[model samples]
Target: MRKIAYSLAMVLLLAACNSESTDKSTAEVQTKQEVVHMEEALLGKWRGMIEIPQSPLEIILNLKELSGSISVPAQGISDFAFESIKYNESDVAITINLGGSLIKIAGKLKNETIEGTFTQNGQSYTITLKAYTETPVTYEKLLIPVAGGELKAALEMPDKGTGELVIIHAGSGPTNKDGNTIGAGSNNSLKMIAENLAEKGIASIRFDKRGIGDNTALIKKEENLTFDLYVEDVKAIVDYAKKDDRFNEIHLLGHSEGALIMTVAAQQNDVASLISIAGIGRPADEVLMEQLSASLPPNLLVESEKALQQLKAGKKVETVSGQLQSLFRPSVQPYMISWLKYDPQHEISNVNVPIIILQGKKDIQVTEKDAENLYAANNHATVHYFDKMNHVLKDVEGDRDQNLASYYNPDLPLTNGLIEEITKFIKQ
Candidate 1:
């Protein structure tokens, strides 16, 4: 038997009252311990890879309350459905019967992850599985509407929930709902924030951007996407939360380019508050000039800036130098033109809701000076400069480049006081 009723009640109560203090003390360590679940925490899509000696094998497991499906993408087997799924204590026992052939996997679920031996064809392999914890709240999925179609967002609910809602907008580019992208980059920053907010009894929704991640189909036939479209997408989410009776107030937390979007959206809507993390305080063209100067060679930097100025003057540069083609390429110039119009400080000055500007001192992308400029725009706005925190909101002291390595690390937990500070503000 499992302590279903007891654990559920206790966790919910703890989430409602002592969220920040309790999570600060026990959240990180809990990952190494156990989070016993007697309910449907095990019911969702889980994707991980098995640690083979030479190479890693990818696997996907989709589980319902009692039935499930498993797949080995490399093996050319897709969706081997199974009905014999059993839950016992903290263990998930799955037996897949493929007519004459079978694969048996029994995993121990702990802290939203599963690790166990995978036995198949008289061979055992070590495997670890992490749930697609985007919507870890009631583990609920939120479908948001847009121009032509719907977008997918995950709601990470607080234990008892029924409090405040925060719509998290990730940085620019192709960052997905979980704060990750297609290629080499993987940082679950937004997901971590949602999970952290859950401990503070604050609900949050993070969704994939249009033309990215699962929302790609939403913009399949669309072209020439504008920055205001993103702001509209977020506004739609806020409107959705307004209808739901679970949240008393709605908050916006935006990182990098998202901060600008949230700021513009807040001006048009009645949001409770706004939090800007690693946000730039200048126009997109100015930020790009700074970024290019640091990364590109001196000669190439000059060429990039000259071309950017032309683009900023509402004129298109048909031919870009070879060195700057990757950045000012024709494909992304339309978006850049749309983005360069809004100056951060100017937008921040117009925002109606209270705003908090948070900048990491060690962030190479956006420095503490950016936060200062944002604060300088409105002396009344709250500002926080994290000492050793990086742009990804992780504590990384010493060298700046070495700290950037944490951005690719998916397992690193957020720095201390991040959840604590944000929670205190929203709750207050």
Candidate 2:
């Protein structure tokens, strides 16, 4: 579904007080001395938590002499640099620009902790930080070489090895290896899946796609991207796993758009099994039209349909309305054209390996009909539907608002029976 635009206009608006250019040389020297003293006292690693209701997110700030970076493990963000850091005698203000949204942290240094207010999009939350130390590594960070550049990935190995490895692929639209996207905050769905799988003695690998997160160097231009390129990337990952001696079996698991990608890749690569979670069964254009029809105005919906038609026919629409540009942008049209040609059912039907389809009834983005269509195309595939699960693989018992809110909550565990079913399917 076309929700928020993935491409962000990252404009860092620094609120630091600038010294007047006309200041005397003596004033400049004094300012420089003040800054050096501030850096000496504040430059170090600090750990804290943003007290988000029901989900307190842990954050780590590493301040160097001149620059600083923040890491949110729950969000799978590591060492993301701060746009600006301003400090005085007892107070510090750090600003980070994310997808055009400004996250400003204002903190006062207390006796042993930095007490702060974290504000983002008009919402403020209390935060506190103390000095931090390095911890033991639980997972291994990896970089798999592809054609253009290396793909950033993490490999999680269980304490007890099962000799089985599952390659996890994230969904569409700037989603990182952790299943979190820009502007959507973090749910850690894919990251949770990998951790849970590891607990069951399964190894897993999750990677950032070509142009997302750490792999941004892989894409020279967005217009050059294609659906087939994603499939090829999966095959490349599979090849990497095949060469490693740690695993006896390799399985591919894809969520949302990744489901369709893995489906096509499974046919070309030598994988043991395939898993699809909340994957679309129809052509992507049909699904896009259905999703937009509900949210867009009648005029915009008509234009969206026309654009989809052109893309489906292997043609590009040069003209797109301002409102629809995020979805049908000129640079992204080639990718849409490549994606629109694949029918999930048709792609799944071509897979020779064992297949399992996971669907959730409460999923607002994908319907049960999509799963049924995939099953109809390949009756041999095992299908499981969870009554309470939503699209992010989280359980929801309330109305639409609660279901949508789960998208931003990383503390929520995976829906009951989700990991169990996947584990069972893989062991079989």
Name the top lDDT candidate: 2
Against the true structure, what is each candidate's TM-score?
Answer: 0.69, 0.78
- Weakest 10 consecutive residues of candidate 2 by summed lDDT: 10-19
Q: 47 in model 2: Cα distance from truth in Å? A: 11
Estimate every model's Cα lDDT from 0 to 1. 0.73, 0.80
Q: Residue by residue across 1-428, what tens digits does model 2's lDDT show?
A: 12221211111111111112211222122221124236355668888777665345567887655456676653335566667777676777788755446788888778868898988767778988888677555689887878877777889999998999999999998788889874456798999999999999999999888866657556656788999999988888889888889998999999999999999999999889999999999999889889898899999998889889989999999998777777787889899989998989898999889999999999999999999999889866989999999999999999999998999899899999999999999999
Worst 10 residues of 1 by lDDT: 24-33
Clashing pairs in 1: 137-157
Scored by TM-score, the top model is 2
Error of 1 at 299 (Å): 3.9
lDDT of 1 by residue, 231-270 (tens): 8899889888889989889999999889889988889888
After TM-score superposition, what is the CA distance of residue 45 in candidate 1 from its true location, in Å? 12
